[model samples]
Target: MGHDTVETPNLSFGRGRTPGRSTPYAQYARLDELHSLQHPRSKEPAELSFIVTTQVMELLFDLIRHEWTIARQALREDDLPTALAALRRGTHAQDVLVESWDLLGTMTPQEFNSFRSLFGEASGFQSAAFLHLEFLLGNKNAALLTMYDGMPDTQDGLVEALRSPGLYDEALALLARRGLELSPAHSEQRYRPSEEAAQAWRRVYTEPEFAALQPLGEALLDVAERVTRWRQRHLSAVKRTMGGKPGSGGSSGLTWLRKSAEQDVFPELWTIRNEL
Candidate 1:
């Protein structure tokens, strides 16, 4: 049979005579429930854009975290190609996340202010999914997990992630398996750049025998750079809309975000470049 002439099955939906019968896409996606989530506090036209943008960012955060988890698991299994593929997908998702601000970028300060007061104690800092993404990227901090204490299920998930092996941990483990000496404490604690870690990567970059690690290192750096760009863009967005005002959840606003941007994830990956 010619390719274009191949017959495809058209199964009947069997959604009896109801005028508003649900389609398979809607049933699988729960799109009606998803659309119902955007209950803006005010009738201001800009509020819908603001709400939808925030929701989209949240979904992207989850997407990135999911990819990171897959990469971390692949590394644990010594599957470098799978891990690198997943990390590359994560970078693309982060790129979308960075551009998501453009939606809100269209709103003026007055438009944001119209609905800002309605946000109450809510803030991006309260985003469990973003925190999960950070945790998978090895930005562990038990103190920050306290924010979710009010929600036991969320707090438990954060606690589990806090103790679980992170992406950096898996990377270090892979290096160790390849005969490099490393302390388990490196994974047990929040990741910090160390001389040994840098030398390990230097070997990967410099020695032909370990060239395989180079792509993984570069993939991780890609993720790190995208995250930094996101932080910078987020800071700019906040400054443009809110000025120096305190963030909704008692955060120090721009000062806090700028400091966060300074703390680079995958620190040793960047430092090793100087040696190369």
Candidate 2:
């Protein structure tokens, strides 16, 4: 008996694709291009792990930034439910970002040293995606923009992010719209804790009238706490792998990270707890 062959249907799974020729998963995900991105500069087997993990982190940073941007935009429109949903998603991304340190947390000093030289001035400090996340979180530092002077497109993007109203800024604006008074925050400056902002948040926690905003305040705090955790985990991972040595990107390594980890992400949100 002869068996008849069945022809596969030509289905379009992604844009501009010959459907029957390739696996839809690979084509849609562009897995070939993503897998091709890891070009380790050294023969050390552990180098690939480091490079892959770093790339994974950069992708997560971009994801979290995207969520925060959505939240900021939603808050600008006074859509509390939408803003809270986006912030909750951002915190979940931040949670994964913190846990990603597990991939590199066990790197021995010798293993890192084996490929460290190959990195040569390249460092996570230079990650534009992570910097954008920082700016969106209101950690603006104009001096850091100088680092990307050679990369004009990246610098331009960072300049735009730096000048845009941050996630916290929109939250405050929403509060002001609801009859709470708050001083305008400087878009291009690093976030500073203000008594006025703290008092506003305190009202959210204590006053029955502003009780509707309590969830929004809590969601913002959740995001801030996760960001602090991510920074602390980064500091811990670097300390264990490289000790007090200077960073590959020309910063004071552990010292700089320690200072950064110590700083709260949303200062007023944290400070308000003392009074509440």
Candidate 3:
């Protein structure tokens, strides 16, 4: 007693369209556009590996930044579980980022030289996304903004990130709110370890009543450890591929990386351990 109803598919573009144009996956991911972006300046096949690896790392950097932003906001709201979940996700992304160096770890000096000239003054150090990550991690260095002088939008974003409270700052504020005494962190300045922060974290590790806060401390330490590993891997990769050369983008290369590798992410997180 009912009439059959059927939905008609849209056929204005025709059914024989290429997969790149018609597939839902391709349209959502913009596969065709992504594939079109690679234009290798050098004919050397190894260059493709370099380009792809760099691009993948850049994407991962943004992804990690996204996770951290979520985690930071959650921490501000005292949502420990959400913050921890986001940090765990960010650490997983960090693991992928660390492993990504394997794609370039074995490149011989000869292979690198083939395309090194093409990079002329361009360097991974100039990545705005990575800089955003650094700022979120409390490594606020305003001088680096000069690098983006030609990119007003990027520089503006960096300025805002630089001025905003970093992940650790939010965590510290949460600790203070929870009755732990700590000095207020100035988001625009580079982070320094405070004895007050050290004492607060020490309580988190040692006091039975503060056991709930231990996981937050551990999560932060996990993030810090992964960041250190990323830096170490980067240093090792550069040393293996091009020993002691001045870096692209006017960086000191090995010297700069060595210093960076020595610097701790979330300094108080590690320093507190000695007291614990």
The RMSD (Cα, Å) of candidate 3 is: 4.4
- Error at 66, model 3, angstroms: 0.6
For candidate 1, give the lDDT: 0.86
Each candidate's clash count: 0, 0, 0
The TM-score ranking, best first, is: 2, 3, 1
lDDT of 2 by residue, 1-276 (tens): 369788675454334556346676777888657877999988888899899899999999989988999999999999999999998988888888899999999898999999999879998999999999999989999999999989999999999999999999899989988878776665699888888988888888888999999999899889988888988999999999999999998999999999999999878888877777
Model 3 error, position 231 (Å): 0.3
Evaluated against the true structure, the overall lDDT of model 3 is 0.90
Between candidates 2 and 3, the one scoring higher on lDDT is 3
Candidate 3 stretches with Cα past 4 Å from truth are: 1-20
Worst 10 residues of 3 by lDDT: 12-21
lDDT of 3 by residue, 89-181 (tens): 999999999999999999999999998999798999999999999999898999999999999999999999999999999999988888788
Candidate 1, residues 1-276, lDDT tens digits: the string is 556686443334432325566668877997657867989889799999988999999999989999999999999999999999999999999999999989876678899899889989899998999988888878888889778778999999888898899888889889889776665453435677888888888888888888877898899899999999999888888989888899999999989988988988889889877767
Model 1 sits at a Cα RMSD from the real structure of: 5.2
User: How many clashes show up in model 3?
Assistant: 0
Native-to-model Cα distance after best TM-score fit, residue 231 in candidate 1, in Å: 0.6
